[model samples]
Target: MDKLTSMNVFVRVAKAGSFAGGARDLDISRAMATKHIMHLEGVLGTRLFNRTTRSLSLTDVGASYLERCQQVLLEVEEMEAAVTHLQTEPRGVLRISAPPVIGSTHIAHAVSEFLKIHSDLTIEMIIQSSPGDLIDEGIDVAIFLGALDDTSMFARKLASSSLVVCGSPDYFEQYGIPETPEDLENHSCLVNWAIAPRNKWLFKGEAGYTGINVSGRMQANVADPIRIAAISGLGLVMLPTYIVGRDIEKGRLKVVLEDYTSPPLDVHAVYPHRKYLSAKVRSFMDFLQEWLEHRVSVIPPVME
Candidate 1:
């Protein structure tokens, strides 16, 4: 009779594929379970289950309802846990979104470490260029690089990453190293469309800030391809130190224009504003900020 109870019973029946099995799991009688499902169907004006003596199956509409019901039940459980303050330790699946570069490298490594500490929690990492609609996409946290455009969602500054312009030994040998940002026009500068001002690379020097309109033989939407191309001596690339830091350390790439400084981009952990911030998200936000700070101190932005 109770809506939440009926929903739970329906979910159990749908999962177990039999009224008796679901009732047994819930410690309720088969008739009662059937009554709950019937009550739900009556309220919704649809048949939730296709009945038979041997097999039980859900109708098309019932299948959709089952998914929604599961989500609702999970939220209700989390809400109660939060209100009671019984969920201090992180639990449940944390869905995160981040750009491809950081997602695969830094954020992914942070999650591995976080999971080791919080064994009760699970994580789902979504790697994409855009942050997208966090609420609509069901993202619990999104690691955002650069400036925050949207003012609606809540964001916490995680860390800042400096940018570097670099190329392979052979590329520098063949094309000559760029002494100033103006010299980039003479060389092939691999472009990453994901970064704003795709055609222009900004730099600050003794003179002042300058935006150089650069062109290249190759350009990609994501940084990896362009980075690889730069490593192969195809062109020079200007990218955040986080993305190219290891490469510079490994001698795979060489940093040029060391005298100049490009504006550092601030990384932020973004999430939709909610009345109750889940323990998992709160813990991760604090953990990641501290983690990145330690990592930055241990590893210099550029080897050269």
Candidate 2:
């Protein structure tokens, strides 16, 4: 009782001018082709084909129905083709969210490079310290650092950056360098309040992991402010090496507690969970992964 299938068979039979020929083209038995045409005729309550011993031909009603069926089939084919193209080619506006420091330094470049390759795609980037609600914000992908808290979304690890506790040479000269994690309690540490365990920092020692509660005169929700404060000799700040690497190289900041390594901050691309991911989201995620692999040396060579 599939009306579309019946219509298709009818059109094939009409064009072929023989029930056997139509059945052969459709890979159906001749009897099944006759049955499909009969089913269509029953629905319309009109004869679709005039059959004689020697040949068969379409009736006036059959001619009209065949023309209409051809149109319908063509439209269905077009719809399918459009969907196929969407599956293969990435298009549409890709909404992304990321932390301000990472967004400005790394993601901005990646996005610019990605746009150069994908001419049809448009990008909207939202840079903030807080990881906003992806669904409410209509975010297609969220670039994140550290551990993922929300299990509802799908996350792919992009790269990992070493965490270093550093301060300006002038600041260290005044406040003195911390020889151990315990010394941080006495030092004025500029904390990134945006990250969890705001006043507390973790470090790995010879024994094991140690957590230290820190206090400072300055605190901010973003890393850039903390980084600037550290550079300006306001206080010591702990940040990813990617952000502080150049500063350290230039002697604007000096890392402390070299033996006590902090946990490496892992970067990830998170998206809402769905049965089928869109081509735009998938393509961008893949591109970002490859881009980070080539662009950032934050991750250790052993890990690579």
Candidate 3:
């Protein structure tokens, strides 16, 4: 096989995690997959994989090479999209990565609506936690919140969400309610690990913003569980307003320190900067942009 085919085989094997799996995905024989990998490794003079009887994994160098190879392959796909843009519609697999909560609460719905009209498009979504490296992870588009420090990537503002400091009404009633940020020092605080100051919850409002280091019996990295804990009267959790909106409205949870709430987190659709975008990427982005315009909120950023 040629270099492009070799790279394709390598990426498929790396993603599939086994020669048999890659062969199944590519509709080729396991023997052919093994031969292609062997040829590529021989040309490169490296052992790309460490294989066992039942499993396969990339070697350290192979792990790094797979990232670069996927980008190169994507660039080639983009070139093809540019050539076919006038004659063909955006119709291909668009891989997306997003934080679990955001993907579940919002993006998934938007993607479903998008697929209604773009019938030829396919979507592969990975629901990951916050603080994941998007480009190295090999995704076409990433939906996330807060500050994106990397200037090399492109980010488009999608929406905003506010942070809520609250708990169940029963919990507040039992704890006698926290009258000020300083009161949180003795309160049970549920921490979201995605927030940098793990012990200190940030609040912004009439007092011009402050960080309160809190002690709690519960802490988690994801919002779903945090919400559950708060609803069950576990403790006061500082979560994005969007995540806890219905809960608060339904009296399942209560909002506290509203006067000291922080500003909203800006949600963005981020992608690697490139000369051309594949049809899959372009269509997905356009659909997302249209969908986001409707969900624009004045609230603060969530766990992502």
Candidate 4:
């Protein structure tokens, strides 16, 4: 049996979790798929799947082998891609993932301009607040804000936006403005639970970086909802300037604690590490860096 072909079939079977499903995906028959798995198990002297009438699942050894198979397949794919497209221009579908607010506001525009420049290239943008598994999703690139927790992936800084603590004038009038980070404890602060550290908001104060535990009636896993709540005078909110800069300019919200700066929100283009990066990924990364630099430069300065 061809080991590489068997590995590919096994991977598809593992991912699909059914012989018929895997066979359909590869355009092969279920009998062929079974033969491949049987060959693999015979060679390894173990069962790869715990088969039953009700369900199909991987055994302990199968789970470990599946991970290695994925890595090998990915490497082989990248190698082939590098050789086939050595001098070819970037063309084909480019998959991207990003936070909803940033994706809709900024990345949408960037992609529009990028597509206009590269006529042969198409884009599939997934607007998700949470960072989903890039490999499982077949995402070519992902736009991330703030610090990245996964160090295994490669990252390139696109731009940075300052975080601002702001509230509606009506809200300030009702609750009074917070004079310091600690004062946030006394005020009802709207929280974007999507951001890390949860209810604890961070700032640079006299004693250096400090986190203030804040509470309010409103909390959400997305930025827009909290922003809407703040605009409606429900509570104070700390958000990136990119989200609230226009609101502040129009006098809908007023930034407080300007003296104490929150950490800058760094935007990044992240991708899985590869020996040879694809032309589509490389070209888009370059385009995004240039696009965002211009975009960030034009943001209206926040008022004191």
Q: State the lDDT of candidate 4 residue by residue for 1-304, as single tens digits.
A: 9999999999999999999999999999999999999999999999999999979999999999999999999999999886677436778889999898888877888899899988888899999985588898999899988789999888899998778899999999998999888999999899998676899899987788789999998999888899999999999998888888889989999999998888777899989866578888888899889878856534453322
Candidate 1: C-alpha RMSD to true structure equals 12.8
Give per-residue CA lDDT, model 1, range 1-304, as digits (tens). 7999999999999999999999999999999998999899999999988988899999999999999999999999999877566347688899999998778777888899999999889999999998899999999999988778899999999998777899999999998988988998899999988777779898886687789999999999889999999999999998888778788888999989988888776789999975578889999999999978755423354322
TM-score of each: 0.69, 0.86, 0.66, 0.70
The local distance difference test score of each candidate is: 0.88, 0.85, 0.80, 0.88
TM-score leaderboard ranking: 2, 4, 1, 3
For candidate 4, report its TM-score.
0.70
lDDT tens digits, residues 213-302, model 3? 887887787788878988988899887777777777678888888777676667888888665677677777777877665564633232
Q: Relative to the unseen true structure, what is the C-alpha lDDT of residue 38 in candidate 2, on a scale of 0 to 100? A: 88
lDDT of 2 by residue, 148-251 (tens): 88898889999877888999999988888889889998889999876667798999877877789998989988888889988999999988777887888778
Residue 170 miss distance in model 2 (angstroms): 1.0
**Model 1, position 220: C-alpha lDDT score:** 90
lDDT of 1: 0.88
Give the Å error, residue 290, model 3.
3.6
Question: Using lDDT as the measure, what is the rank order of every candidate, best first?
Answer: 4, 1, 2, 3
